[model samples]
Target: MKRIKFLYLVIGLTIFLGCSKEEITSIGQQGDYITNFDFPTIEIFAPAKVGLTNRSKNADKFLWEFSGAKTITPQGDTISYSQSEKMVPDSAFYELPGEYNVKLTTWKDGEQKEITKKIVVEKQQPVIVVPENIGVFLEVTFAARVFQFPGRPVSYEWDFGPAGTSTAANPKVTFTTEGPQLVKLTVNDGDETLSTEVVIIVQGELAKTIYFTDAFTRRIYKYKLTTQSESQVEWIGATTGYNAFGLSVKGNKLYLSETGFGTRFSAGDAAIADGVLKSYNLDGSGENIITKPVAASLDYRDDPWMHTVDRFGNIWWTCRNWGVRVINASSSEAAYPAIKFNINATIAGEGVSTYFASDIKEVGNEIWVSYAGTTGKGIYKYGYDGNYIGKFTTAIQSHAIRTFVVDQVNSHIYFATNRADAGHGLGIYRADMDGSNIISVDTHWSMNIGSGGYSDQGAAGEYVYITNMDIDVDEDGKGYLYYGYRAISDIYGSGNPPTLGPSAANSGVKRYNLDGSETASFLFKGYAPYGLAIDQVKR
Candidate 1:
């Protein structure tokens, strides 16, 4: 009797399994419909006309509910068409910026299923045009770009924080404070309102500010220097991670290069990794890591030592062992490959392999890079295409070339070096573009500890013995050269020990006229400046 009961159950189970596999159902069976639809998942800007398409199967009836949407008629008038019994509804228009729901319901054989998807409409912000450079007490013009609303009249209101507010489309505002000022713009188009904000950084009264990186503190500092205003040193509040070495200012951006994971004395391919090149807005906003190393392939040879930004938006950096590398500032790659000039190969010597490719600068359409190592010591010039032009200068090759800057207005190339060599005597040297008529710019103060100078590391302790320099013209059309100076108090007379290193009285940044005359001495006193840049834009 039990075997007969089991046989009956097995037959029932077999019939049920066959029905499920075949998807065979009676005319009034439940759950036999597929409800599906699609809408744009990309940003939908209002007023947006979004089309909803049906992809349902085995459904006898369909319904669509578009939350609070209107459909445009053939005569151009918008009418409510929020709900429809059709499979695909008319194009729904989202007049305002917000989130809306789209519901699709399908019914088959007296059973029903529904699904809902969200559609978000984004607000289109008005475009605001602000001047690149703004200074305290300086009147600058701000404009709201014309954005047509077709049939509706537009009105603009600008809120320049601390500078007051304006209703005019273009407003001339004079900021009274230094630092970031949040400027907002709101546009009303009778039907919809859109808004946006931008931070307008108001700089100090100086027409030009000298930006320098302090490697010891890993911080950025600025010295506002102008003949018309008081010279002041302000911390820029931007912290550069490990081994901050280079700073370059192009337009409203400040670029920095950090040789990650190694000290200046032991930096090499094997000793380091995680190097990066980054950029920050002059106001310290928009901090971004432009490039770094890819994890799977680690090579510190691609580490950025010193960098420069060209007008073409290309960032050229000198990798200590790998020569120079170039990548567009807008690149989104995890790591950028180096343009291996194998620059050391350019020099003919056994020790050329140990040659360190140092600071790089962008002069017009060309790139100039300085190299200093055991063998070759000079600046090499390259075309904008990364092809080596020639050896820029061996004039001061006796000294380790830490940095060099081109003065187009003055037609001079300034070289700042260490090692206090006999012929050139490590300081600041200026030469013609062709490396002729080399003149001493400023070599009187103390330089880094190398072949000739004493080591200050034991006392105050210097991390890297390097000097960075830059050139910028003022509003008065006068060009000046600024270079970091690590002065030994007794370089000439007083016998202060080398361990005493850089003193507050003599160590700082030195400013000189284009013709090699000293302008300001002992600026940013006591701080050992490494990387230097100048905001050349007239603020």
Candidate 2:
């Protein structure tokens, strides 16, 4: 019985030992054991000294102790233990830059760990310098140097203060206008940014000669009749945009046609009369809308676009809707009363087409009007009295006509016409005062220069210069002709079925001897050199 009791006791003891072992194993699996501890160490240097204060991490509680001037006990994970209070060291120390170290201790469970880190801080920010106050002249080019901190990715932004801005590390910028400008630059570091500013004064100067091309941007430029290469020019703005036809000069005044207000359709509402005659002073100041006449009732398409100033300073213009109207400049309101005469009624022709009147010379005592049209293609000479003196057929397709010069010395009338079967190439035709002896000089030879090709005409001494469909020429008294060949494209016909291939190059003004031999060809500056007026302004 005693032996049985001993065995039972041994079994009970074994079960008790197994239960304790299982409890200890479960506790280990639950991560209750003391493992490891870690802390971050720091080092600092200022002008060259370091301070320390006790810091710890992962501890249920913290106890910080520092060695140096004072002992500090910080309760947080991080503490600044430094001897000096300044963040950066001064550069006054020429040789040795000081270094410092910081110790950090951490406790977790029953384990503890410590670490140290070193840091060095420099004094003062980087410097950027530029030359002292420099004055730059307007529109003048100059150079300058730029300085900045070394060993850094320096970014620069220059604010020229004159509204000019740039991003050049070291750049040369030119000032075109006069004013006080504030120049500034900015440099950026990964962690910080710096900027500097300078005041710059720019002086102004006079601009050179102004250029006047066609009615681009609706601005009119007037040039003085002088030979100074750099003469100053003035710009005048038009109330209504100027068309491609250009301006006409008579005496000391100028005359231009303003196709009033753009519209969407032919029968749209009249926005201040479809056509207006504008007059300007010689100095480009006293600009006045001289005439506004509703000559017709057909929605005034503003089509038959042509304007000329007669010797009496009166303006004569034609319109697709308005047959023909004459403006009396001498009148208080510049009245334009329709010309009442046989030609105005008989040939009252719709789309009166192209017409030209001389700038009023004393010879004929009557304002001679030359007109042509597609419906009834003929050149008619009308007297100022509104009487049709005579009419004659010059060419089958004489859709338009322009007077080159009415030579009172020779009683000869010179004009240009687009008379081809297709009405493309224009021809230079001449006739006597009575409309006889009409002849056509094939201006384009056999090439297609197309309509709207006739450019300009002028008289320099006895030689009369005529610009035709694709050529320019000067007619000598003895039947001698000089021609300038030019290349021109007809944009009006570009949409025809299939393409007209590329526009041919029979363009560029070419000069020819009166006998039709090629002379020197003077190329113009741009394409479609349509409105060719001699800049008699000596330059």
Candidate 3:
């Protein structure tokens, strides 16, 4: 009977609960706790002064009271907090990053408002700094933010891609080879790890190129000295007009001048072509034809040769039969006023024809010119305006100099004697610019006995190079002066040193000590080369 009574009580409770396993409480326990809201925020890296854009930021401070509510921070981490009178952190300074909560409260006329926000701080990633491009044997400094940040962990690793790996946070790397290199950096802060990666280009040694217009190749080419790695055998651009002869290099730009020797240049093409000066990119792109019109000089040459630019960017050029002339190449238009300088203007001798010049150079505030064949003084110094200032060297008359270049070190002129006779000519000659000390750098026998080629010469630092292309053929491509250099031999076949003929043997660029001893030699099959310009890349 007692069991039946307990069962009835259980049934009554079940009817009230209605199949739900929920606690049934009296109204006295309800509405006892206050409700709260959430406002979470997040940020990254450093400079951690985060700002909160609150709509009620302009509310009167007197109506709101501030306090830091229940704080839940990561273990062993401490955070600095600054609060305003409105109950919000003025500067969100989370020194140690982790998950935590911050609160804001507001009161107006006895009305209260409250907010609870969760703030998450992530580990700052390391920033790496290195050269985007570097040459061989160059010292590259690697830097990282992890090494500079205040209070950063001492544990860090650095990997310089294929260069090598290092335990240091900051390392200096030098590449022996050339190519793209990948770099990685990692840092640890006891609780978290941050990583960063970047790619660095360790470029190889800039190609050792001789930029020149080969009358034989009939195209301007950049011949490489190192190897087959960084060079092109044939690189031609749109014909401003074929049978062109000289190119000037400034920075990465090339200025090629076409001499309308026209039918005079080639026999089959009877059409008279106009001489044009055009500008091209280093790799031979962007042909900008420069058409500056000027009345032909009353007394001299018209076709242009190698040109030079002044500090103010003025184009000073030399012509075949004409004296030195100036053109304002600074304008963008294809036309410019050509100013012809008086050829009789001279301080040395009145008979000097300024029009007969080659290799026009502007060094400092002065302009210098080199003359070929049996013309006026071999080299002449002049004012920028073509007024002869003085004589550089006596007439380059007898030697029949094929080409001449200046020694960067002093006022010495290095000229090449182009006569075919072995004993009297076909040698390298250097003399003071003022016609003072004349010395035979390499005689005909010296060339035939060594590397049997002699055409052009260039000097840089402590070394001088000879471009050995004996000119036995005409400038029309079949010239022996093309590249008739063979190995240097003390004995020429039989008795004494006999002069070799064209097609006998040939070589390319030969490097020699200041004393004319062959230190090294680079051999090429055949080339129509003139003048050597060593371009040092400026990073």
Best by lDDT: 1
Model 2 lDDT, full chain set: 0.39
lDDT of 2 at 326: 67
Error in Å for residue 531 of model 3: 5.6
lDDT of 1 at 356: 76
Per-model C-alpha lDDT, please?
0.68, 0.39, 0.47
User: lDDT: which is higher, 1 or 2?
Assistant: 1
TM-score against truth, every candidate: 0.56, 0.41, 0.68
> Model 1, stretches more than 4 Å misplaced?
1-206, 261-270, 294-301, 346-352, 393-399, 420-422, 445-464, 474-477, 487-506
Question: In model 3, what is the error at residue 314, expressed in angstroms?
Answer: 2.1
RMSD of 3: 16.2
Per-residue lDDT for 1-539 in model 1, tens only? 11110010101111254345663222233553677887665666667787876667677787788887888888999998779776456788877768999988878868999999998776555778889678787789999754455587888899987789999888899887789889999988777688988877788774777888753466888876665457677787788765577888887888888876553444344355667888888877788888886654546666788888888898888876767788887665446665646775645333366667887887767787876665556777788877767674446555467678887776777886644554765457888877677888766534343433422321222224454688776445476777775544412212111134334344567677764455545555656566789887655
Ranking by TM-score: 3, 1, 2
lDDT for each residue of candidate 2 in 1-539, tens digit (9 for 90 to 100): 11110010101011234545442111112323332212212221222223223222224423232232122233422233433221111111111223433344445565765555543333223333444333233233223332223355656666666547766665566655456766677656444576767666654332211223232234555333222123243454533352323245555555555544332122344333555666665445677767666545334344224555566666665553335556665444455565444233345444443232211122355544444333444455556655655555444224345333354445555555533423434656555765566655545443334543422221111011122121112234322222223233421121111122144243333322333344334332222222222222222
